[model samples]
Target: DLFVLPSYYENFGIAVAEAMSVGTPVVISDQVHIWNEIERSRSGWICSCTVESLTETLKEALHNRAEQLDRGKNAQIHAKENYSWNAIAQQMIKAYGEIQRANSKSANP
Candidate 1:
């Protein structure tokens, strides 16, 4: 199955991530902030926000069974590795640690 969203504006597009988490291939607009990740992971198709683009993307995505399965698996893996709660927590912890290290260096120097 394919999840399609042609939003004109989106902050993070949590729904797209949710679809990816469930191993569903997606067709999302470039307006989504996380489109870069989707593109990098080969998890889905990205298109500009227009009827023509969305329709063309949908046509291409809907007919490719082999690619669909591959993309679905990639989507699941990408979501788990990058968007899961544990992943978010780990990122936050790493960021905080970096901040702490920077502060310590400044204080000592």
Candidate 2:
């Protein structure tokens, strides 16, 4: 399933990640928080949430079967590496450590 989310205000865009987990390429709006990551990973196409942009991107994707398949494969790899439970837990631990250090600094000051 190719997932398309022309969102105006999406926080996590879990559906996008879920689709990617199953090797689906996406076309998502720039407003989605994970858009930058998706773009960097080459897991999907990103565009501003506009009729013209979405249409143009979809058209471009339709003409490139190899590119679409490549994106789908990349999406699955990225999802496994970045959105898996282990990955999320590790990130959470790292974030908590940063928060603790910041709090300690403020307390000491």
Candidate 3:
């Protein structure tokens, strides 16, 4: 299981996505920027940041093992399709190429 807290003072939430990317299910606090994404992707559960809420959410996630497995699969798929380094590199290259071409045209005129 993976836990993510996007609060400004998170002790360690950055590893959540990495774990999820490798097929681990995630439980995220609403304070996290990726909470909505995780929920929408069905990759994990989201809850309020309080201890009570976190405990309840974690309990629910663990009790629903089948559902959690499904979510983990979804998370893995999403991570592969959206967060892969190769895809990100391609996107960055495309953006840079576009900017370079635009700059060249502006410079010519």
Candidate 4:
């Protein structure tokens, strides 16, 4: 129903992505690297790495089933659109192109 990770420090947060992929709304701390994506997608709640913040967010996230379901759906869509293999590949290709362009400009100059 809900996935909560209130870690003091997190890197990539693959677990959060995995949960979003499965349409599970999350409550993650700001320390998670992917928290920005989560916040942008409106797929879950973000809280500070404190018990009070976590508890309050958990309560809010658990309070309404309808809102939870909506957020879950948003999470699923966000994961598919951003974290899917195709999406990742496209991003990589775009980054490579940018690097190539920058290199070309430096060489020509």
What lDDT does candidate 2 reach at residue 52? 98
User: Can you rank all candidates by lDDT, best first?
Assistant: 1, 4, 2, 3
Per-residue accuracy of model 2 over 22-107 as CA lDDT, tens digit each:
99999999999999999999998998989999999898877898999999999999999999999999999999999999999999
What C-alpha lDDT do the candidate models reach, one value each?
A: 0.94, 0.93, 0.78, 0.94
Summing lDDT over every window of 10 consecutive residues in candidate 3, give the lowest-scoring window. Answer: 3-12
Q: Tens-digit lDDT track for model 3 on 55-91? A: 8888898898799889899988877776789867888
Give me the runs in candidate 4 sitting further than 4 Å from their true place: none
Instruction: Pull out the clashing pairs in model 4.
Output: none
Per-residue lDDT of candidate 1, residues 37-98 (tens digit): 89999999999988999989998998889999999999999999999999999999999999
Model 3, 84: alpha-carbon shift in Å?
Answer: 1.7
Q: Relative to the unseen true structure, what is the Cα RMSD of model 3?
A: 2.9
Summed over model 1, clashes come to 0
TM-score of each: 0.97, 0.86, 0.77, 0.93
Write candidate 4's Cα lDDT for 15-38 as tens digits: 998999999999999999999888
Summed over model 4, clashes come to 0
lDDT of 1: 0.94
Off by over 4 Å in 1: none
Instruction: Output the number of the lDDT-best candidate.
Output: 1
